[model samples]
Target: MTMDGKVALVTGGSRGLGMRMVTAFAALGADVIIASRKLENCEKLAQFVGEEYGRKALPVACNVSDWEQCDALVAAAYAEFGRVDVLVNNAGLSPLYPSLDQVGEGLWDKVIGINLKGPFRLSSLIGTRMAAGDGGSIINISSMAAIRPAPEHLPYAAAKAGLNALTEGLAQAFGPTVRVNGIQCGAFLTDISEAWTPEVVEVLTRDVALGRCGEPDEVVGAAVYFATEASSFATGATLRLDGGVR
Candidate 1:
């Protein structure tokens, strides 16, 4: 139990890569807090985590895009666990893959609000609590789109690039007490895959050196490592878990 007695809050923990991160933190002996927009979904996930890991799991409904909601989320987690040791800024959205010419302003704002602003708000709210405690780690889940421009996903790519910049900036600003890093994930088999067709998956797989898409668990390993003491010296870094796509 490398993270014994620690507390972790994972946004968007109801499903996908976020869910896997919640499980990983629980397995590492952290009392996990799973938050999302739906209360029922978080409650169900909390029950499962409690049963599987035999540790306290708290679930709270939160829309990370809202600053007030993020504040409430941090307050609830602190109430349950007394402190936040790890914060996984995983809540994000990639609505539709529209080319820059086809993208409307409304859709662009929505995507950026959820993908970039959400993490920024939650990190600020939770990072304060962490600073008060014994310091903590912040893992921002970014994407390869931040490095490689996805023309079809213009808004998403731009937002993720901003998130990458935020990760680095926060690491430097919150140093000596807190560590901030990011994971630039490639292709992972998650609900987001529904956006891709079979042809797209086939073409993308051919480009990956691993010859297949990454699993949710594979990405969770990096999240767990960053959350634990193993990455104590690591900060202002972006770990690429993209099946050697670069």
Candidate 2:
């Protein structure tokens, strides 16, 4: 799908899946706004996209967990591009804790804030603008844990489940124009996977139909689909990019 002349703003657009998406969109001819907590990482990706794809890239330092920062990101994006044709809520974190009982309030809040709250705030802000403007697409990068909750990642699962619900509700709220969808992803060998033990990796791979974790770029097709007219009639849908996780 060609996104020529369009603008895309992606949160967490520095490393992993977000990084891949930034480049993918740029390659398809969309100017990109890369937002992340680290200014240097975002700048590096922005420079790469500009130099490699010959597309404009704006780097904004933001921690999606904060409401004020989310507002600022939107302001910055609109100020730079005037409009955002695609918005990807890709920033998230699922930190490990010793046990459920040991999940302190700080940890719980941090996980929920980054994974759920941020998406809600960003979507609300940008979706409204998209609905009022020439229409656009909003994609949530969720996890399969949202549906198949595990004790080890209950908080993350809960947050992602909320994100799924938000996807559906927002589709209606911003309908008749702006489209909203979600990508429920399975295990991917991202930077996060570097922490997985050999046994953990084996267990993750053995049960999936694909027989292995996905590469970072594997999710690009789905992301591109939702971001463009390829999924023109698919708002409120949550596509499983999980390689048939079971």
Compared with the true structure, all predictions reach lDDT values of 0.87, 0.96
Candidate 2: TM-score?
0.99
What's every prediction's RMSD, in angstroms? 1.5, 0.6
What does candidate 1's lDDT look like per residue over 1-246, in tens digits? 388898888888989999998888888788889989998999999998899999899999988877788789888887877888899988888776536677888888888888899888878877776776679999999998888876777788899999999999888777788999999998899988888899999977887889899988898779988998889899999999999885
Clash count of each predicted structure: 0, 0
Lowest-lDDT window of 10 residues in candidate 1? 93-102
Q: By TM-score, who's the top model here?
A: 2
User: Candidate 2: what lDDT?
Assistant: 0.96
Segments of candidate 1 deviating more than 4 angstroms: none
Candidate topping lDDT: 2
The RMSD (Cα, Å) of candidate 1 is: 1.5
